[model samples]
Each structure stands twice: as C-alpha cells, then as structure tokens.
Target: MPITPVKSTKLYHLIVEQLKQLIQSGEYRPGDKLPPERELAQRLRVSRAPVREALVALELLDVVEGRVGDGWFVKRAPDSSLDVSSVEGRPPSDILQARVLVECAIAEQVAAHHDDELVVGLHQAVEAFADELRRGQLNGEADRSFHLLLARASGNAVFADLVAYLWDLQNGQFFRLVEGMTGNERPRLERYVREHRAVYEAVETGDAGRARDAMRIHLEGVAKDLLDS
Candidate 1:
C-alpha cells in the first residue's frame, strides 16, 4: 500500500485510499508521521493541492491530524466505514484558486467602470463584514456579500451567478473543515476586513489595476494562511 502516482482526476480520494490502505495494512501505526506534502505530491506526480485536500479530509474524519508547524501524523487507523469520497465537491484551495481568477477579473471590471450606486453597495458590504468582526464573530455570509456585489457591479449576470455558485461551495462542507483555521482569531479576521476595504477603496476610486491586485493579494493571503505552512 505504498503511495504511488495516481492518474485519476479525483486525486483527493486516491490519496485518501492510499493512506487508508497503508494504515490498514499496518504500514503506518497510530502516531506515525506521514510524508511531507511536497514529497507525497512528487511521488504521486500531482500538485500539492489534492494532497493537502485529502490530508485535511482525513483530519476531519479522525484518521489523521495536522500540527500547525510540525506537519501531519496518523491519528488512528482507518475504520471500515471511513469514506473520503464522501467529501463534497472540489477542494477548498481549488475553489479559492478559481475565485482568484474570476473574482480578480470581477474586481478589475468593477473598478474600470465605477458607478455611484455600486460603490455605495460595496461600501455597505465592507461595513457589514466589519460589523460582524466588531461583534467578535466570523461571519462568512457578510464576507460573501462583498464579492457577490462586486461581480454584479460588473453588469455581467454570468459573472455574478458564477461567483454565487462558487460562493455556495465556498460555504459548504469542503471549505468548513479549514474555515476556523483561517478566521478564528481577532487579528486575522481584522486583516481580512482591511483587505476587503482595500478592494472597495480601489473600486471606489476607479483604479482597475489596484482593484485586481488587492483582490489577488487577499485571496493569496487566504491560501497562504489557510493552506500553506
């Protein structure tokens, strides 16, 4: 049950199966350390994205555990009923990457064509998010509004709906497993509000380049803080 390159597109489950089989066969005992993500991705001939996704899913399922700086370790042997495939839709990082593409474009477009009403709506979105944080809460819904409003401001129904669809998945089970890891702290959440406001400011000033850069920086921050070491 050694890890090997998998050709399937759904690599999250493949990684899960490989790890599960290894544990089941007594190759990895409880408390055994798993390979680093980089090494596993190299062996599997895939990027680290799916490997990280599978590891997080395993952590959620109680089969493994991730130590913030120390890396991942076996929590326990996989039970007969453990099913990684039961994980919903695309991985969280996958969704974030998609957002980086579409949302950044949306930001650029909205900024390029500034409208008074749109600016007001975006400011309200930013304020709503800040209000939730002020209450010492991590409000995902408030955060969702800003991006959706920006997309709609682009005057492209397709962009708005696509963003909405991605936002739906972003709030789903696949993303929830690691949600707190990114936004549980007052400082981190505050930083996110600032990031949102920065995007809003750029759009309000009609700075297309700055809007795109702000959005990209914000999403990159999420990926680094949530996904990477």
Candidate 2:
C-alpha cells in the first residue's frame, strides 16, 4: 500500500515494515501487547537499538503506546494516513555515534586553546543546564547552549555550526522520543549532570586528550543508559 512504503536504509524502518505486516496480519491486534524487546530483537536477528527505535517510532505515530514497566501495545490499526514511513529521523543511537566523533574533537580542540572567558562560559553553561535539569526539563535552552559553547570554544565557526546541526537533529521530534522515554528516572538525571561536569573539569584543566576521553565516555554512557543497555 501507498507506493510500496517509503524506501530507506534505516534498520528501524525495516523493522517498522515487519511490524506493520504483523499488525495487518492480525498477529498483533489492537489492544494486544507485543513481544518484549529482547524477544523482538531475537526474532529480527538484530540488537536492541533498532528494535527500541522502531518501537519509539511506532509510539510517535500513535500506532502503539508504552506503559511504564510494560512493553509496547498496539493502539490502532495503520491507516493509509499512517505508514511505516511516518517515523523519520536518525535514531538516538546514531546521533550519539556521530557525536562521539565530532564533539570529542571539539572538546579536544577547545581544551588546548580556551581563554578565561571560555572557561567562565563553560562553567555558566554547566550550571544553566543543571538548573533546567533540576526543573525536569531535558531539552532546555541551557542544555543546547552548553554543547554549542563547547564547539564555539574551539574558535572555529564551522565547528559551532556543525554542533548546532547535530543538536538540531538531537532535538528532532523522532530523536527526542528516545529521551522522553527515559522519563523521570532520577539516576539518569543525576548521572547526566555528573558527566557534563566531568567534561567541563577536563577542559578546565587544559588536558586536550583527557577532555576528549571524557566526552567519549559521557556520550557512550548516555547511549548505554538511554538506548543500548
């Protein structure tokens, strides 16, 4: 139906198609609880990342809903108005993988040449983020400004714009779903603050290598806590 489903190479898209088939075939009816993440991953011969992304996509499409501490449940039938293609955007895991390469380099460069103004900016940015986080807003302006400031600290206009681009993607509706899925997990909230502080501390010490490593570890930890693990 609908021009053979929007063509794409994303793994979650393929999973979405498979799931659509299941729903259409009556294997997963409305009001039915689908298989758990591990079981679906096993069935598809993939890991949890793509599976989770697909489910989140479905959730965004209003095709399913996730009850706290429970798995996905079919909410409605897929009309021609809502197809697998409805879910679009790089998965959260993919965004983090890209950041591991780009932002880590930015952290390293900034550590080597930042001025007092930059250091003060980073400190303010970190606290700004912490303040918003304390108010329970994940996508607050301060959270975005912190990363952009880190890129700006590198003294490269291109780096700042590039980081902004990545942040835009991270702020996209589909990608934001992964974060919203984290809900109000207090440990996740505190851990993110601590990790951001670690990066700032490494940069403050002027250790380029340490700053890069800290960024990498922080991003990897985020992916683990939010997606993979």
Candidate 3:
C-alpha cells in the first residue's frame, strides 16, 4: 500500500526534523552534497513539493545551500555557543545600542527589497503575536519571527544569519527581563504586540521611511522600559 499524503505543514516539518537528525548524526556532514531529488523523494516517501519547501526552509536557517546545477549541500553546523549568561550585569545601554544598529540596518534593507512574500510572512507573524498576547502568553517567539522575517526580506543572507545569532544570544535575557518587568503590569504585554504590528504595517505598506521609523521607535521604547524598571 502507498503512503497517505502528508499535510503541507506537517510534511515540511517532518522533512526538517529528519534532515536535522541526519545532520546531527553526521550522515549529512557539512559540505556533503545531498542526494538528488528523486533519491530523497523515494527515501522520505514524500512528493518533491514538500521536500523543496523543506529545503527552502533549511536554506533560510543557513543549514544548506543549493548550487546551480550540482545539488543541495550542507552548509554549517548550528552554533550552540551563544553565551547569554555573560550579558547579565552588562550595561543595558550597550545592549540597546547594539539592537538599534542591527534593527535599523534590517529595516533599511527590507525597505530596499520590498518582497511581497516577506511582507506577507511579517503580517502573519504580527497576527500570531497578537493572538499570543490575547491568550496571556509571552510573545517572544513571534517577536523573534518578525525580526527573522525582516532579515530574510533584506535579501542579504549574511544579515539574516547574523540576526538569528543575535537573537539566540539575547533571547534568554529578554525573557528574564519580561518576567521581571511584568510583575506589576500584565497589561503592558498588549503594548508589545501593538508595537510589533506597527512595524509590520509600515513594512507591508512599502513605506521604507515609515518602516525604519517604526522599528526605531519600538526599540527605543524597549530601551526606555528596561532603564525605567
């Protein structure tokens, strides 16, 4: 009997998870050319579409690269050395300064590219963020997704990778800060969701100027809140 068709989201996730295992297990070492599409399809028992989508997602994660005529190859191992503990006791000013520079650069690049798919992804991220906030959940994942979408929109792989790295470095600090700050005011979570939506709207409208300004304002507010608390 033939295998049943897999849902797109589930199929893609399955592909990603399997591929991750292969990489981690050393079956697919860095720079190793993946077997051709036919072989992959046969082995994974899925159609080419989900495999292709999974490849694109992995590429976004900087795990694999596709060469013009050759095939996909492993790129880099996921870096696990991001040291967030060291950031404690460091000046908040330094962190804010770094965020301002990185995010502003991301906004400018997204404005220049103006890719429709990227804008759509950003809008989805914003909606998800709002939903999470309404449920009284932390919006950190959505927040990170929004920034990653911006990095991808910028049309610069290096920028996207760097943003991912920075997020890994700072995400722990962010959660701790959020928990500490929300002790007295849970409603303030709504403000963060709104701020992210504002940035998304500005980018989706293709107003580069507005996008930059919105990101700047959001980051500045984060800095202020951190300092005030």
Candidate 4:
C-alpha cells in the first residue's frame, strides 16, 4: 500500500507556500500567465479550493491580476524609477488631500462622541511610540500604531480601519523614503512629534475644529518637506 500522506497542515496554507516559492524563484515571471486553476490543482495534487485561496492571497499583494475572462496573470514588476524619498514617496500634495478628506471627517465624528476609554488608549499608544522613537527604533509598526490609536479615538471604526489599511499598504515605501533623508533633515522628526502632540491636545480639550486644523497644518508641513527635497 502507498504510505499515507501527512495530513498535518491546512491545504490552503500549503498551496500558498508552494505558490509563493514558485513566484519567488521566477518560475512564474512577472506578466506570465498562471496555469488554469484546474491545471494547477491537478499538478499540485490539491483541490481547487486551496488553489483558489492561494490565488486570492497573491492578488492582495498585487502580485497577480485576475482578468474577467482570461486566467490570472502575473502583475508587472513595480516601477523602480518611482521616487520614494521620505519627503517624496508620498507627494506632500497627495498626502494633504488625503488627510483633509479622511482625517477631517474623522475629527468631526470624534467630536460628536467622546469616549474616555478610547482617549486613554490613544495616550498609551502615543507613549509607546515616544519610547520607540527615543530608542531609535522608529519602525513602521510603531508609527502606524500611533496613528491608528488616534483614528480609533475619533469614535469612528470605519475611519480607523480605512486609515490602518492605507498605512499598512504604504508604510514600507514610506519608511524607505524617510530613510534616504540626510541628518540635517532630522528636525522633521521633532516636528512630527510636536505636531502629534498638538492634535492630542486639541482632542483633550474637546475642540473638534482645532483638532482638524492641527491635523491639516501637520500634513501641510509634511507636504512642504516632500516638495522641498
């Protein structure tokens, strides 16, 4: 009798791992068409469900695009020429526009409904971010968490979730852009800390308009720096 196959792992995860390896190894080069799901399942000796799940996961990473009628195709490699310089990666103009649209709306909602618990959580997150900054480990996670806390404190779950998703999507490139800046530009970091403090103060005072204004000003400075370099 053939030896029993190991049943220790979830099939979807196994499929995902195998597919990831194939992509990484260049076996599935960018812009190359992937085999049909049925063909892939047959070759991998797995069911269609696992293969489908793997494809979905890859799509989330922008690695593949699913055409309406055609099979899944690899995405073109990201442009290397894109300027990701800290002040350039997210054009200050674009960042300002996004902040005005999203954050201002969040501030209005938060002002309408105050919550002591959420405020406390925001304070804790800020403290943790400060600690990380002092330790010289201003990684993306801490930076994101700090902003996420403020978004949540605004008493709008949808706004918080949206901001979190955007942060996750852009953080790697954002960090890379900032990393290229010279030491003379280190003052930008200090300015960011102060800006965050001002927003927190406005929230503490229950001044929604002030909070919105503070956030707008902070993002304006960020945009100016991006244009300066």
Please tell me which predicted candidate would have the highest TM-score against the true structure.
4
TM-score of 4: 0.60
List model 3 lDDT by residue over 1-229, tens digit each: 2243666447888898788778978888998999987789889999998899888988988989988788999997644434354345456677777778888878966876678888888889888878877787774677788788888888888888777866665554555666666665455657777888887777777777887888898888878887786
Candidates' lDDT values, in order?
Answer: 0.84, 0.81, 0.77, 0.69
- Top-down lDDT ranking: 1, 2, 3, 4
Steric overlap count per candidate = 0, 0, 0, 4
TM-score of each: 0.58, 0.57, 0.59, 0.60
Q: Give Cα distance to truth, residue 60, candidate 2, Å.
A: 29
Q: Which stretches of candidate 3 lie over 4 Å from their true place?
A: 1-89
Residue 192, candidate 1: alpha-carbon lDDT: 87
* lDDT (Cα, 0-100) at 43 in candidate 2: 89
Best candidate (score: lDDT): 1
lDDT of the structure predicted as candidate 3: 0.77
Q: The CA-based lDDT of model 2 is what?
A: 0.81
Clashes in predicted model 2: 0
lDDT tens digits, residue span 18-63, model 4: 7767877788889899999999999999889889888887787677
Model 1 stretches with alpha carbons more than 4 Å out: 1-87, 178-184
Residue-wise C-alpha lDDT for candidate 2, range 91-165, written one tens digit per residue = 778778887899999999989886788999899989988888788776557767888999988999988877787
